[model samples]
Target: MMVLLISTSIMFSCKEKANVLKESIEADIIIYGGTSAAISAAVEAKRSGKSVIVVSPDKHLGGLTSGGLGWTDTGDKSVIGGLAREFYHRVYKYYNTDEAWQWQPKEEYGNTGQGTPAMDGENRTMWIFEPHVAEKVFEDLVKEDSIRVDRDEWLDRENGVVLEGGNIKSFSTLSGKTYSGKIFLDATYEGDLMAAAGVSYHVGREGKDVYGEEWNGVQTGVLHHKHWFESDISPYVVPGDPSSGLLPRVSAENPGEKHSGDDKIQAYCFRMCMTDHEPNRVPFPKPDGYDPMQYELMARVFDTGRKDWFQKFDAIPNHKTDTNNHGPFSSDNIGMNYDYPEASYERRKEIIKEHEQYQKGLLWFVANDPRVPKDIQLKMQKWGLAKDEFTDNGNWPHQIYVREARRMVGEFVMTENELLKKRKTPNPIGLGSYTMDSHNVQRYIKPDGFVQNEGDIGVETNGPYTISYGSLVPKKNECKNLLVPVCVSSSHIAFGSIRMEPVFMILGQSAAAAAVLAINENTTVQNVDYNKLKEVLVAKGQIVE
Candidate 1:
């Protein structure tokens, strides 16, 4: 929360020792993220014998892998080679020993999206795992690589540093640390470093016309799942009443263009960590600013004898589950984070608090309310947070599942067609394959007083799609020495697939590998000889198919 102010009388240059007005540290490569990608890139840099340091905003790294997305969304497993594949193997090793499963039986936690033991052992590639386990794997990589890591240091983007010719001379952080490196990589989900480096990035969803993407903007009536109520859905603006007033949080304005897109982005939420064991369970506390009216749809669903209230808890290792929003008014904090991608830190903090309250309140209403269905209440009441996980933060996970965010408009913008396997790029740097999934953008009331959700759409993009190198690097003129891995240049639908934790790791490694090559050769990141880069990547097991 404290920003170290920079002083006057600073003296420095790229080669000379910089007594930074703020604070100073010099390295060959400086990475600005705690994500798996950041770790991968830093490791790659170290393996190449480069001096590197990671200044992560998070105390813990691994992004979603540590965040709560234990069920990995991998496309073609074979395409998930190199560091991405190593990460999964590490998870398997964690579960290899019997002691890893203290809560649940080993057989129960087996077959977690990996290949089965028998029946020809299905030729699998992608790997899924537990949240803490993923964090451990990331930590192991840091330890094995002997990489220098500094946590909780946010970048001072506005007046951090600038380039004289084209390369990034240096950058500053809020924690009185100025990082000067020959090459820099922005591996954060928010693309903060990229934004600070003056690279162009888009915050909201772009129209289909803007990117020629079929799946771009505000999708209103397009249903992607079978969670909607079977009976007549009310749109009466009020619960049970034909006309009382618009329900709390329901948008009054119409979001036009069902097929095309808009500037509004999809929602985000923390994947709640819940356990069924009573010894480890902590009852859901009613969050401050709790509003029952916001969860009226949930009540309606429960009143109709709905037994599918817990459909979102995709069971993870032990007896724990990675819980996300299953249907209407679940954990996906619908319509509340429309401005989070580009919001200021204060504004973003407020949004996070609001989301935390909404999610916490939702759980409380379900667990303690008399209005909830008996069977659903009984089941929900059994679950609480695990005792052994996230010990520092009351067992609740620290990272929020930032689904999507500010994407750089780099040298090349990956589009839906590429992700859908419709087109091929000559400069393919990595591969990603996952369904184009977006959470609800807004909640609206129908004419019949029932709720109508907007923006939740899942389109399956078949095959291991090609990801362009330009997706990671900005146009040579924008910032030659800078690279972005998490929020790389890509269309909304395309980014949905590329935004996975594994792919970020792959791209992170690739970005740093390219950076080291660029540093060794006096050329822009654009001019790193692909053959030489590919050699190092292949040696590292990175699949650039």
Candidate 2:
């Protein structure tokens, strides 16, 4: 490996002349994300005797795992194997020490998970944890494995990647640093590298006819979750007055027909880390653009005798809760993130800021607004941002949950048919058992002139299902050296199941194993020997059923 340094002069906003230094590093494998999957891939690559580097736009690792989704969306514990399970095992080890449980006693903390033990004694795994603890565990892995991670290095999506003969030769970041590798893994939620490399991908939901699947497209009538407005709440500012204009956040467009295709995606929100503990709680600050009228619909919903604002206040360790979007109008700023999938970096930052402002304002409204029910207001006031977590970023999560993004159209596509056990999957690399869950894509006026949210679907998989290896690699003609674990080749509905954090780590390990094999055999990633790859993965304790 060699590092080449290049120097250039650039002018900044202040018109100040500064020297821009660029470094080009060569490695056997290049992982272009700081997600949990990216860490796992780097660990696997190092174990296979390959030099690897993690070029991440994020300062922190573990994506949502280290972010605030600490509730753990994993379905079956048995399916989580290899490095993914090892990660949980590390969490268990962390908690075994007295220092890990700072807010509560270890014995007093009750064990609770998704129908599983929060602290699994038999398997030596811990499922539920705080956000900082998860980040620490991931950081420990990087340290122990000596994995090099370059933080806050954004990929130049428009003109960064260089492809030669259907393979990526090298890719440069906005920092002007270039990375050349024999194989690359796009483990990011946004699939920035894959998109910049000219790989085919899909952003929106496909019609049922295209995939021959029931849950692929716009779902108008299905009410899987309690996220929709229960009562016939008016969409207008004045009740039943169309000329009064639509209420804030409610879409003016008509919700399309059921099962029809549309270029819409599920809403995104920050899985807020909140605590009610007296010493650790930081009171919600009223955002800059806090608008009381924005939550007028929620206030009306409360008038209809509903007080379930704390329904999804899922508990984590140390009195912290991974508070999520709940009810008709809650943390989810619906329909505001449709342009985020393919938007520019600058535009994406604006969207993120808008989401943060909307969610923060919602919390502040619930805590202080007189329009809210007195009981709800008092309860919300008790909880605040955790003081011990995210200290660098105003006690809020640093990453926003990009629930779904650009999914690569690779050699194989995982669909609901495979998830529902109607069709057999091939070349099993990992197992995904989470429910096929997708949040509402749009909130629009119903034919009855009432506001309603659409596209929320939650259907449980029959059991743990195998994820194919082909889902990770692009088509042979498209890109030979790249593998995508986070944005795998799958239909929108099927991706809901595969998008879980543990499954992403599993696929990351599998992708790394395949890349190592391809590098050893001097073949394309598509041409890697599956039998040998499966053998190596299983030997490493991966669940490759």
Candidate 3:
């Protein structure tokens, strides 16, 4: 009897192990990202009666939206619709509650906003918010929708996507977990999934003639924003000694010809969330390898009597500010992130850490260093990182804003023509109205022997223009079951406008709806009927044209 009992127990244990092996996860749609787009896509899929999962490399959701970028980059509020606008309305609803205001009184935080009213009482939309509030909103969306999110599931880019006859059967992550789906959406900023799937994409600025775009290439001559140095700053380590070599952050290479194309990408910076409220502030700590001489150029710029030091301290709520890069030498670690687009996971982590150290050191220098102007240093001392935010990541934002990355060269390549409304957009999925904005791509030596920042262009679109549905999908031959919304097919200049968080949610919802439509019809994503898709999108309140 004892022998039989032991044998039966062993048998049960083996069966349990087998059951665990058999319990692999599967979904109708698999969204690979944790950006705002990923959440929208998952919610839309659930609403359409399809099971979806969000497998992301990031631990947090909502990307930059929940990161430090609380001040919205919205161009036209009317163009935002569907799940995108719904999100803002939810933000409005959250703030409406008495408990939502923690650090400040609701009445005190009056009706100040950007171009439009931030606290819109009529339409019920709130554009600007705190970072933690945005994150909570995203978390509420996932919980309310009952969406499954697998965080920190890094995609095995080398050999993970198992494609069967141009269709992704499944993809594995570095964690040895595999997710299977009928339809897939690559909602990542870097377009990692699309790149891994062998989809065609462009990394840097395309030549002007490639897409017949005026702002597509090396824009050395154009100076749109006040980001460039107003007066020429010497690039030498010693004031005028070229033999002393270039100073830190100043590249010695020649900036390419004006309007010529190159592989350089725009500068990226952390949109810092700082507060003067001492109770909720963490003083900036000196980072390892702190070098005060690195910012010599900025010190010189300040010495030139430019007192607009606090120009871009865009305010949010609760005495906090969305501090962005402003002036010639500010928060933007320019020309240091060239390898981030195609970098490996480990390499990318290193880059992110490097940025974090640089920014932290900069803040420390501005507040405490004797080299900084006395007036500016005194003012900066009052501001520090919000202690209530990003508790898991040391009060710093988890995600850096990847302004531009690998853009899928899908069926329709959105250029300035489409943005400027020179050509009609076909099968409209969403609308984008933000200016064709691009930050300085490279800070290099000019021909006249002075340091200058290049590739900052800002040209307003004629009006709200439709984003093509074709831009979301890979070429019909490349992959039929995949949709890329965040990294949609667009030129470098065009993406600067479409890369907004709200626009991403709009396209993400559209992509999810299309995926469901394709699944229902037993057809490929490319073969889904546009008329049928439009009907569903309109019903869902998408701004489809």
- How much lDDT does each candidate structure score? 0.78, 0.92, 0.89
lDDT of 2: 0.92
Candidate 1 TM-score, true structure as reference: 0.91
Ordered list by lDDT, greatest first: 2, 3, 1
List the candidates' TM-scores in order: 0.91, 0.98, 0.95
| Highest-scoring model, TM-score | 2
Query: Over the stretch 213-284, how does candidate 1's per-residue lDDT look in tens digits?
Result: 777787766788753445555544554775576666667777676666566777788887788977767777
User: What are the per-residue Cα lDDT tens digits for candidate 2 across 1-545?
Assistant: 52545666564766566777778888999999999999999999998899899999999999999999998999998999999999999999998998988898888777787778888898899999999999998899889988889999999888889999999999999988999999999999999999999889999899999779999798987898899988888989999999999888988887777788888999999999999998998999999978989889888998898988999999888988988889888888899999998999999999999999989988998899888889889888999999999999999899999999899999999999999999999999999999999999999888888889998999999899999999999999999999999999999999999999999999999999999999999999999999999999999999988
Candidate 3 residues lying further than 4 Å off, grouped into runs, are: 1-23
Better of 1 and 2 by lDDT: 2
Stretches of candidate 1 off by over 4 Å are 1-22, 110-126, 227-231, 235-237, 240-243, 446-450
> 2 or 3: which has the higher lDDT?
2
**Candidate 2 Cα deviation (angstroms), residue 259:** 0.8
Model 3 alpha-carbon miss at residue 526, Å: 1.0
C-alpha RMSD in Å of predicted model 1 compared with the true structure: 4.9
Candidate 3 per-residue C-alpha lDDT over 321-364 given as tens digits, one digit per residue, 9 for 90 to 100: 88888888888888888999899988988988888988898898
Error of 3 at 142 (Å): 1.1
Q: Which rank order by TM-score, best down to worst?
A: 2, 3, 1
